[model samples]
Target: MPKALKIAPPDDVLTMLEAGVAGDRVAFDGGSVQLIDAVERGHKVALHAIERNAPVRKFGFPIGRATRSIAAGEHVHVHNLQTALAGQHSYAFDTGANVVTPLPSTATFMGYRRADGRVGTRNEIWVLPTVGCVARTAERIARQAEARVAHLVDGVHAFAHPHGCSQLGHDLDGTRAILASLACHPNAAGAVIVGLGCEENQVAALLERIPQARRGSIRFLVAQASADEMAEGVALVEELARAAMAVRSPAGLDALVLGVKCGGSDGLSGLTANPLVGRMADHVTGAGGSAILTEIPEIFGAEHLLMARAASRATFDAIVTLVNGFKQHFIDHGEPVSENPSPGNIAGGITTLEEKSLGAVQKGGTSAVVDVIDYGVQVRARGLTVLEAPGNDAVSSTALAAAGATVILFTTGRGTPLGFPVPTVKIASNHDLAVRKPGWIDFDAGMVLDAGMDAADAALLQRIIAIASGEETAAERNGEREIAIWKRGVTL
Candidate 1:
């Protein structure tokens, strides 16, 4: 039997956890009401009669205006509702604030300490290409060198992406930033940078951006400079491998950089996976580590909640710009800003961006917004920071990897089989998804509802430590790794 979940006191709709036939009595705090319609799991049912064109509330806020008069115990979804968001709007700092308690540093995770005082969860050797032209050559070098260097580093893998050449300004800069960030990422004990001569992103300029101490670990090659690029690239990787084979020092939890994200969301996301992950985020940030939250556009309706917890007025202002800028970007592209809660989301009982946003942000837990960063920028602060990115999973996840997230905590309701260059821990929002897709899911956050929250949080924190100590994620085993770069500017 599915019990109806009415999240807030003022909500006029109830999300059914399982289907109920007509006349079934559904109970809430006030009293029990007879069901007048069949409400599927994850779908909503009207708690009270709402007049035509009146607001339909969920998460204790208006999700949309009802298109037709809805009877109490009737289904409420796309057919009877429409979005209410439009254009840019004025925002105040805060009326009510989010609470974040400072947790004592008592927990720790064992990790590898780099020579530059950084920490890495993995010690793989990464091969990065300056342009798409040499992506194949970079991969060839990795494939051939993996066996030769298996006895040295953790593994040798190449990250290949499209669109490196014929790009101007930010487009080209975005490519360089992403590749360079990954090249210097903690997971990479050393890197083999492959460049096709004449590509806009040159080796010397890229090397200049890497940390001064770690620059020595990079091995460079220009495909056009050698007749046998494959052999030359392979030789360079071999040399890089031997250098990376050096022993790594033991490190603690403070060195961990986690990227938190949610995708394919449903009603259960907020109540289950996202909030659970947010608890983990708070744990990591409170323990003196770092956690980054991206998918900027997804934060739309719920921006005010985060703003209330902003560390300073400057950070709040940046959040405003980041939000309004994305709205304007949508306008310039001739797309509606309220175009969200995809078909799948609606089918799964998410009605509006507000509801979605509210649920989405639970992944941040109660952390204060300490910093904001541009796409491709690495995290420096030791708390929660926001990054500029669209809601596209691949692009944002790749950006998270570039931003120095040694491990990515990805929560999903519908679930995705995709993986980034780093270890991606897929957390399922519901037990059914976890049961059905055991191969794809690494954690079952749906259990948060049944098990005690404290026990769940402690278990998840331990799970994260196990992953940090070099346990292989399902994505790594299934070979779903890929990278997506943001292309915002015009191409020449």
Candidate 2:
């Protein structure tokens, strides 16, 4: 028999757990409903009669309003629902006590201790191009140098991007900031910054942004200045590799920094994968670690939930500015703030931006909002930080890595094979996706539906520790490593 779930007590809709044909009886908590129309799995069915313009509640909040009077057991979707979001609104900081008991720092992982006192999950050599003109050159240097230093470091890779030139003001500054951050990333014990000297982003200017302490292991090369740039790059990497060798030591759980993200989310994402990740976030933060939550536009209708949990009045005010600023960006572009729930999201049974945002924010669990930082800035706070970034998968994931995330917990219901600068643990929201794409999913959060959260949480936490201790994720095995910078300004 098909089954359905009513997520919260105030919810007026039931989400179908399995596909049901017309006239099929589906059971829920209170009563059974005979389907009036054929409904697909993950789709919502009205639990009771709803009048036109009435709020449809899910997750104990209004997802949208009924476009027309909806009969009991009828399908509740885009046809009958409409978003209630409009322009930005004012908000007041709630003075409730938001406290999280810090867990005893018992958990530990084997990691490399950097000279600057930060722990690194990997000790690889990275080649970064300062401009698009030298991207291929950087790649060639990495490929050639990896063979020579394969036994010394974990691996050698290059992150190539195209926005180092023809950008002005903040656009140019953002590009430089991100590059400088990547060069100083703990994962890369040593980095070779390759530059075309004539570009807008000069190697010297970019180097100025990097702290003097981190510059010891970083090498800079100008292709225009050297006759044999590739050979010189390889030699520099070889020297750094020899000097970058460090023994793995036991590091406390407090040393871990996580970037939580979601992509290709389905209806069950909130109930399973996202909430599972939220558990992990709470566990990490409670142990004095840090977790970052980005994708600003996706939080449009659900910002109030986070605002109420702000750690301080200043933190609450920063969140308001972060959210409203993103909304204004949308307005300036002549786009609607509620223009979300991509085609895949609709196919996966998500209805509006509110519904998606509600599910998306679950990755942060119930942690208080500790801080809010701009794009390309590294995380400074030790708890939950809300970052300023858009909702694109690559852009947000890359921003997460640059913000000092040693590992990223990425949840997906529709699956992807993309990885960023760090180890990306892809979690599936349903069992079917995990079984169908084993090569793409590292953990099956769908098991929460059957085995329950306690069993699943322990298993997932074990996997995170193992991955942090040098285990390769599915994305690593497939060689899906890549990075993308947010390009918000004009090309010229």
Candidate 3:
């Protein structure tokens, strides 16, 4: 195997595939370099001398600037590199640069077709709590209901979150929106919305946000109005399950909506997992399918690249507002816009926010920004849609589910076992992590390093189809389903 990899021709740094001590020579595509300082695996090594304050290129873009003069083969990391990101800047819409050729849409997967014309990868029944006070009640109801109806449908699940009460204005609306969205998710054959009756987010009010056609498949229960909440909830779920027992049928690729995300990212993220997911994104959107990319904060430095692909001037303006609004959120809270790349990221070899952002955006592929939606809005476009969400794993994943992602393509370097409302296919950036956490990873993107992206892409697409057709992901098998609401306002 090559000792290091250079992602782009203009990159002045090479990412080490293995640890190297001083004086060790690392070979790459065009040339070789002897290490001037000891560098760990996945860390960056300068390929040539860099002057102080000069930008260091990676992924063919400036990741950051050199903090001081650096010698050839010197280790490049936080010690010598710093982010150059600041508050947002103006942007201009580029005309006709984002057009994508729609591929032949012959691919099909077996999925459940809903009454509303949406296709579902699963036929499970969901129990949702309107207030935090009734979360456990919902869980208890789902457990009992699943035991009885496991043979009738996929499975029963209750998504519990500590919100729906004590929230004001948009914060309260956010809770309602997410819950309403989940209740209407195509994956759920039917859903039961349990409310505490007196909470700010009442069951009746929440139902108003859901479409009139979708409300027929959903049941609601007010805990205070019930004689026995658990029994009432279970009965409701059983009724939904009976109605949800539908057989899967062939569905076209256009029915597939993917959520592309990355977490616990490492240096190899950009090279392997992310870019691999990017190919899948392109493939999906090329076939007229939809894909959603979130983690607004993670795209700070790379916002321009996405903006350049805006479908129209209106889309470009939305992209600008999305980027700047997130930055302002940080500033208003006295936090820097570049306050990211967590300690885990640093240890995994990522240096600055720019480097991380540049790598993170690859999951979106090169698709045109068809639309930019706010938090809690279900996706309406037929291509890559940028959703407003934070970079936190659960929150963004939940938002993705709420935005109508049937399956989430999650790429990671460091591993996480979390699954959201939908099946999350975890792709590992490096081989070591895939081997180390077999239970957490569904695909090894590290194969791209050796077998190349085409091979990896084919394999991953097959795995995704299988998963969509009812093959359980690692997260699903491990029973790691959960949700987290983005609590952006103060408590009452």
Candidate 4:
């Protein structure tokens, strides 16, 4: 073992060695000379054996239970330890809560305060179009408008998505709902709606879904009025930017709608960053705010766990219905949902959808699922919720931004350059990667994977608090705000 790496037994739980924990069988740094069974040298000591059916505890939670008897010094691994049961009945939030202790109230983040009692992390001007036909014109206008008024909002940008002009049924409704949510997002201090005058998504319908406060700060333009001219688009966008720059103020954590996501993961991701970010999610949600977890495909093989954590039976069922419905949609398209994993995921040691999912779900933390919404629906509940979106990090992050995520927590084992509309914090899987890619990785949670860091969970939670409260993350300093919207079925 390296001199800097050490391991200490957790004080909260006891580890049983051999047929029983006969003595103070401590797993510490640099001193061990007992062998009763077969074991590998490099593998983690988590494989040490004990009595049959013994429970494996971490973070004071029963992560798994041993399925077979084992001798001392033997590896306690997946082959012998069965995973903990995942179901609604397994966790009892009210009566048998895990953490009944109240958390400190001193925690807070400085954010942009909105008029209707919401908070924003960044001030931005949005140039949105009701139809794809106007997307080019909107982009041109945004570029000019941003240059004209660069000092006002954080940035002026256009979401050039390949949707809003085709299809039928729920797909159209999904697009309309998402676009409306974009217009009302807290990060958007002001907005300009550009339309082709005739498209599947009309400006009137989009405006109706925007909140009252947002409606007061928006401007409208039709390409027909500009004779479909590019110069007209730039002029209208400039006017909207000037108007948006006039309003700027401090916001609070309550105004934040956190977008949670994970990409290019490995086994250590669950053990490290995901759960750490989850702690942050819990804090944000507990502070009378909202957090959004998306990537429908990533949640595959783990929807049942989230359903069980739902605040109500209705919410649970709603999420369950979405999982099944999306699966059916994929089936209709002659593709398996399991095929969604990226090449990087496989190279980094992830296997099967179920195996990957076991860790992916940890990012939601222990918060109750307050709402289950379709793609593009603005988050309304004041706690953890599920957002409908594809597994692609860019697309899901974009939807979260559209639905109002002021910050995104993105985890990766295989480093990604992807950023988001709001600020993003990147957590690395291992210490080696964190040190090697200091420019991209903000925090190192791989200490949990190291030998000595016993309170991995607690330490990570503290780090998350620091990041959420204005601490610069690697992604933010690198200026990463990658956005992509999943338009699975049709443009409309």
Please report the candidate that would top lDDT against the real structure.
3
- Higher-ranked by lDDT: 2 or 3: 3
The lDDT per prediction is 0.84, 0.90, 0.92, 0.65
lDDT digits (tens) for residues 84-169 of candidate 1? 77888787876326667658456666667887777888888999988889998899899999988899988899988777788888
lDDT of 2 by residue, 164-213 (tens): 99988899999998889989899999999999889999999999989999
Report the C-alpha lDDT of model 4 over 236-274, residue by residue, as the tens digit.
666666666534344344555778888888645666677
Better of 1 and 3 by lDDT: 3
**Candidates 2 and 4: which is better by lDDT?**
2
How many Å off is the CA of 492 in candidate 1?
Answer: 2.9
Candidate 2, poorest ten consecutive residues by summed lDDT: 96-105
Clashing pairs in 1: none
Model 1 misplacement above 4 A: 94-97, 246-250
**Which candidate gets the maximum TM-score versus the true structure?**
3
Q: Residue 317 in candidate 4 has what lDDT?
A: 70
Give the Cα-based TM-score of candidate 3 against the true structure: 0.98
Clashing pairs in 3: none
Ranking by lDDT: 3, 2, 1, 4
**Candidate 1 lDDT (Cα, whole model)?**
0.84
